[model samples]
Target chain A: MPDTGTNDMTEILQTPLHDLHVELGAKMTPFAGYDMPLQYEGIMAEHNHTRQSAGLFDVSHMGQAHYTGDEAALEKLITADLAALKPGEQKYTLLLNDEGGIRDDLMVSRPFGEDGLYIVVNAATKAADFAHMASNTAGVGELRIIEDRALIALQGPAAADVFGALLPAAAEMVFMQCGVFDLEGVELYVSRSGYTGEDGYEISIPAANAEAVARKILGDDRAKPIGLGARDSLRLEAGLCLYGHDMDENRTPVEATLMWAIAKPRRERLDFPGAARVMQMFADKPARKRIGFTMSGAPAREGAEIVKDGKTIGVVTSGGFGPTIGGPVGMAYVDLEYAVADTEFEILLRGKARPAKVTKMPFVEHRFYRG
Target chain B: MSVKFTKDHEWVKVDGDEATVGITAYAADQLGDVVFVELPDVGKSFEPGDEMAVVESVKAASEVYAPVSGEVVAVNDVLEGEPQKVNESADGDGWFVKLKLSDKSQLDGLMDEAAYKAHIS
Candidate 1:
């Protein structure tokens, strides 16, 4: 049964934009300890609007923190090459468990002017991630959670233009570049990176100025407030993983097919957490690998079994109808042999097995503004 | 003449020996953006509580159950081409399947519009 997440409503947290969401007639749902907007106008409308123009999203519920000690020592916990990152550069990386499985996927940034590394993690795993960092990397660096900040992602083709209107400096930054901009007398740390495969910016602003800044952006007719529902579809269409759904603590980097994020330099040293076990995965390949699949018929949801020749070969981790694809799309883990692209299989949705094919990802082409 | 509702959120409108079945607007509001609808074949018969159809939204899929047992006479072919019609006109043109009522008394057992409204609230 899917978790409604509505059980303990009293204790759920609220972002600074909570009242703003309610004022805009957003459908609110409890997610990852916060009552977040599920939709604004509607998922379909917001999703299409983002693809065509720009969509402003309140992702303040996600965890934002900073590490303030030895940078190389802190690098021992993440899979990415943090040491080589120039100031103002961001790296997408994974937090690995001792067993080589992914605890959470996150972004590490060497923010301009900041003496330490800036990190953003999944909302659901933030508590655990922080705890792990505090205990394991104790003498190396101090992890300080930035609870007073609010994170907003302005994504899609028009994102740069929107930010350009507010802060011209941010608009000039290339993808993965971070800079702190003064917006309406408040400091906003803007990064040219996002989960959606779009030319966008993720701005970390103070909680006080979030509503005012969000209002200023939405005041522009080119952008609208998008909710979590459309955000999920956009990310899924971009072939990005939703930490708990697409991957979890049980999935290793090799199994998740995220070798691209493991920088080449890090491969030589292999000094990160679970490097020994992760090396074992490199020596002897993972039996199963995650693949993007085209789902027809009834859309295969998470937990649906993937079957081939009357045998269950894999399971879908994240599956849903892709509005852009005009069909169902999913990410699943299957036996390495069956992981080949174009390989056909049947996904058992409910009690019925429906035809599906292993396909390449980015159901939609990533339009990240690469410089 | 009048519409009846099931606890599962499907509605049926009976006239003569045939009944038009579709999900209620409340259900559609709950589901949010119906991307696809899977209706049973025309000649198929279903029993009350049987899962006869499937409705998929962007994020989740739901099974539309039969509120009353009957043989399907027709289905909304428009839905096959444009499923969003269910979201556009959920109760009107969005009607799922027309069924030949197997048991007329089943309608009396279901909730009336007033009762459904009160049930939802």
Candidate 2:
């Protein structure tokens, strides 16, 4: 029920696969600007099924756009190294504000045979992100938002096998590699990557063929339709952050513990947005850092306060019952002193302080392909 | 004794001064699966419309409000270990608590089975 809005439900947008989702009996809710599926089966069953087998998710709500022209031009406005990146490779990076706060975390991909780059950004900030890119990359590169395509993710251990069963060539692809493949004459822009820390693929298909491909994918014995409810839980268990909840316009990537996404060259040059302030944060160290923690009792939940020695030190950003962990797991921004793994703190839940311990993330170990 | 439902989806079955309380099947299905329930202890008193219990599904947490002013005389002990019973039998064995009504007149405000069925649709 993350941002399951209670306001007037008016003029909500629908994706290309909206009809299929409704036909499959999905519980639809307002997400971002679209009427998206929250669940097909129950959240628990769908969550466990994806972890054990394969889950098919309709991620078309996320914004996909292409920027054309000089690679160095758009690269200057964002964090990832487009010039250094090999064709068919996609890297996760942040779209930063002038103050260095993350506007959105996006995957910048350089498709083969093109000087322009394809980038996937978060759904909520797509408008703002497009505007930012259009203005900043005007002379160097031009941004073109892609709305005619639908994005679907086939995730879990069995995803590759299931996807390969449809397009045998897809099974041959390695991790993080992407390419355009003709599946029965319908073009599939596919990448071997996903949000669930599992072996999977995110396929960009034409809006007209989305329903047919999605149905075909779900036809596999291992693949089942999953919803946004399970998507959040799987990402949490994988230690991935949700925009607006985990980190936002107020916090820098350094403070969000996402310094790893910054390339070595970018760090060396230190010329990106708020580069000086971000570099200063590196030297001084962040006052608070995002940390994973486990707490007993009815989940610490989002907005629960973290306490140490009876003083508020932090707040839980994203949290819920981890079906895999069989316990409540959550992520929080905690004081630097308490960010260390195994450190004990108190999570204030329902007016009572419950015992909690900071731990290394991916509460469930990430099973992404190392190769 | 007759079953009555509140607009918030709570159902109450009244018998003399005692009443059985639980959520309707419509509410249970809407909530998906019940993983954990935090019902008030026996003997706890609540005014009409007061939140007296917490119900957690895998996706979210919700509050169960008191349909009518009453003192909880007994609670379903089975829900603690097997919360799925609510998903299985939302208005039957899954009753959250048995209440001793303090204001019997509050019953006038509740909807009958037909009206509840109509109200939900």
Candidate 3:
């Protein structure tokens, strides 16, 4: 919607570092309207490199937006009860349609001093998210979408060290804490948060500076530009959900195992959009809960059916082989009765029921650095 | 000793009565990142072509078929925790299983390395 297209008329969008990716011999694929790298040095190799050291991700496709207004007016719009959040804290929230379905899942951060609130949403849903947010707000806060920023994440065990060497200001920022800084004359909003199960940093900088910054980080032998393939696997290993796959408008926060993101103040007041249905779900305890499973014969992918006693009960949301866990792992919505740990179920794969069991998430242990 | 390949892209390096089995480099590349591999139990017996292992990538899962009829005598336990080895060196170090040839004549059915390459090409 913001004219993020290339000069070519193919309608296939390209990231700011498209040339860089090509130079690195990356295999590119169309994702979220952008022609993104699927892998470089191969997906398996990149995945192992990230788990063992550090890997760079070009996530410029994610959307960046801001909310500006007085407290009362701002509170009237956003579903999250933001007034309750302390400065420097970030909360995961969602935009909702009138029917109480989620529009997109996002992270809202209360920047220091709180002149305004900053948030990021999924790239695939960003266009719709902006339109939905603009149309649904009750003339409260003026939503400003940042279309010129490029979002990139450097993830894995050696992320901190990589950032410490390249950008000292980013090294000092604690996990979930973000601040503005100048990197070689380029101003960037740096935060220590990532979907990968590794200690990492997410940097938001002007689109013009993306290629140079990416080059600087990738100059290190320990850092490689990972593609969407490894990104999905890393997040899967971390037990993080992919918005359109693991969650959508039809899914509720509670049913998605993201109830922790809902705040107590909002729950008590039930003041935001979709409060009635979400609150009722909170009270009644949804009939189904998202649970992790380990497939036996083969991997169960998204939309695969989950069966119990030969009856279809749920569907697989995100399924893939977990590198860290050394097996095929996935998350699915199953009957509350079969959501507990160690509950045996069958995943329908290629018309065959593969033996599987509900296991505790994440499939692998997370290594986020709080310091 | 010579190597032969199956239609599913698995390869077997046969030496007299013994054979070493693994997937081809092309197959590994197609699978994307090799996160996990479930190998058949040791001592399992199978014919010329059988599903002896399952390889899972971040993208999908595929079966590793036996190129020659044999009895599985050993499996690569290292794959249990380091499946990436398969992608890193699918032919050299990523061998998945070792088999005791039940019928050495079965090796004639699989394609040679050059033939396998041509098939993939």
Pairs in clash, predicted candidate 1: none
Q: Assess the local accuracy of residue A331 in candidate 1 as a C-alpha lDDT between 0 and 100.
A: 95
Worst 10 residues of 2 chain A by lDDT: A1-10
- Model 3 misplaced stretches (Cα beyond 4 Å): A1-10, A70-78, A138-140, A295-297, B1-24, B35-55, B62-121
| Order of the predicted models by lDDT, top scorer first | 2, 1, 3
Better of 1 and 2 by TM-score: 1
- Note the chain A TM-score of all models in turn: 0.96, 0.97, 0.93
lDDT of 3 by residue, A44-80 (tens): 5788799899999999888998777655554543467
Error of 1 at A214 (Å): 0.5
lDDT of 2 at A237: 90
Write model 1 residue lDDT over A1-371, tens digit each, in one string.
35866765468899999999999999999899899999988898899999999999999999999888877766777888876787889989998887878899999988756588889999999999999887777887798999999999999899999889888888789999996778769998889999778899999989998999999999999999999999989998899999987788888888898877778887777777777787788779889989999967667888999999999999999888888888888899999999999999999977878999999998999998887
Stretches of candidate 2 off by over 4 Å are A1-10
Docking class of 1: medium
What's the best-to-worst order under TM-score? 1, 2, 3
What digit string (tens of lDDT, one per residue) describes model 2 on residues A1-371? 24856776478899999999999999999899899999998888999999999999999999999888876767766788776878788899998887889999998886644666788999999999999888887787778899999999999999989999999888887888877888898988898899988899999999999999999998898999999999998999999999999999999988899988878788889967888899899899999999999876577789999999999999999988888887789999999989999999999877878899998998998887656
